[model samples]
Target: MNILELAEQNFLITFSVVIGIGLLQGAIMGRGIRSRFPSLKRHARSASIVLLALFSINAIASVLKFAEPVKISVSELTIPETIEEIFTLIVNVMGINAGVGAAIAIFVSVTLIIFLKFANIHQIARYFIFVISCAVLIVVLLGKFTDFVPTAFQIMLYAFYQFGITVGIFLVTKRKETDVLSGIK
Candidate 1:
């Protein structure tokens, strides 16, 4: 196959990978939160459900966009205008659904973090907030600076951010040594 064909194959693979990893990460985070904060277990479950629904919708939109890519008319556009148009097109193609999903995810994550902070889990909340902030910052930077990056690569990067969140939550909710030892006995 030619390079274009190879890239297309890779793109589909990457999309699938992102979806799988995202689902797994969501499950992990939900379980961790529920275990760590029994009072907030329902909140964790609701967040996970909402996130999953949003992500699933976004994934479907992305696959549809990939299958039938959108075409634009740039003949009358100047350089700057063309750039803007292209950026808009890219955003549309790369799941405006995803943008909405990310926004909701961020809101839910921040709310959870706030609850954690108020509950006196200061250090864990700080780390989780930091990870979420970094993920958002990196995504914004990528959107601004990497116009040349492929859609598949951008999706993969999003998956990486989800993984980071999972890791942060894992650290936050892991059983203490004393708890582990007591359970062992």
Candidate 2:
């Protein structure tokens, strides 16, 4: 298949996987894992609901190619006729086409994690997210410098960046659930 076909297939697969996981997690939240603790279960239920929303939003963004974060410096801002075309041309010229969307999404998710932490929504999970996000963000920002970054490292960074968000969500949800149950708040 051609590149466009491959991209379409990838978008479909990613949308499917993200939606399926969200559904599965939602189902699991109702499985009565610890029915004895009502408050803990409530907390878990809330967290799982938020997780579902996040997964859904991210999936839509990914499928629609809205995950990309375009840098808009005040000095470089312009009123272009075709914004998408302009952005595409710029990104193509810059040669950082691969995984730019995912990197931006990771950064956004990391920001949300930090916000959630500061708001005292999920303390335990926030700490884990802070650490993981730091790692992913570092790789993403550093990836802009191809001369300094090796090809193998870029490939690995891409992989890690994609997987890191999923793992972060899972870990945060798990920790939130368990911490609530164990009276850790």
User: Global lDDT of each model?
Assistant: 0.47, 0.44
How does residue 60 of candidate 2 score in lDDT? Answer: 42
Best by lDDT: 1
Model 2: what TM-score?
0.35
Tens-digit per-residue lDDT, 71-120, candidate 2: 33435546557989789656653434647445555555565545453443
The ten-residue window of minimal lDDT in model 2 covers 27-36
TM-score of each: 0.37, 0.35
Model 2, position 102, has a per-residue lDDT of 50
| Model 2 misplaced stretches (Cα beyond 4 Å) | 1-114, 121-132, 146-154, 161-165, 171-185
Worst lDDT run of 10 residues, candidate 1, spans 176-185
lDDT tens string, model 1, 59-140? 4443333333333334533454577788866664343435554455545556655544454333543464457557655654
